[model samples]
Target: MDHDLALIVGLVLIILSIPSIIAAFSDGHAPRVAAFTIIAGGALLVWAISSKPGGYTISDVPDTFVRVVARYLP
Candidate 1:
């Protein structure tokens, strides 16, 4: 449950950061902060998902976890 929540929140942050990053790029403001945020959030989400509880074993290479993580951002 905790892992799921962390993954969800981190992905949300990454998704939210994209528009701000694009806006910064178009407006000639350095997007360094937004880029950093995206990287950090992505890392956190990956870590959280990878650290899921011991009961379940992941069988599929591209499962719902990957879909949920990648869908909104890309």
Candidate 2:
């Protein structure tokens, strides 16, 4: 996958895991999926950052998003 797409997907996975993590604490139960998501997301994010030519930063996200979207648009 492209660096931008990988980074975006990783961010989304991390964001999604937040809700699962919160529920685990509030409900006194933990889901294995939450743990997996955290690990996978972090790894993917790190890989994407390292794979990028200049190492992605938060500031690069918007431009990355636009560029990727433009590529897929008809």
RMSD of candidates 1 onward, in order: 6.6, 1.6
List the candidate 1 regions with Cα displacement exceeding 4 Å: 53-74
lDDT of each: 0.72, 0.87
Candidate 2: misplaced stretches above 4 Å? none
Using all chains and alpha carbons, the TM-scores for the candidates as numbered come to 0.63, 0.84
Across 1-74, the per-residue lDDT of candidate 1 in tens digits comes to 45655666676789899999999989999999898889888887777767876523346323646765676566
- Candidate 2 lDDT, 32-66, residue by residue in tens: 88989988989888999998888977788989878
Q: Give candidate 2's error at residue 33 in angstroms.
A: 1.0
- Number of backbone collisions per candidate: 0, 0
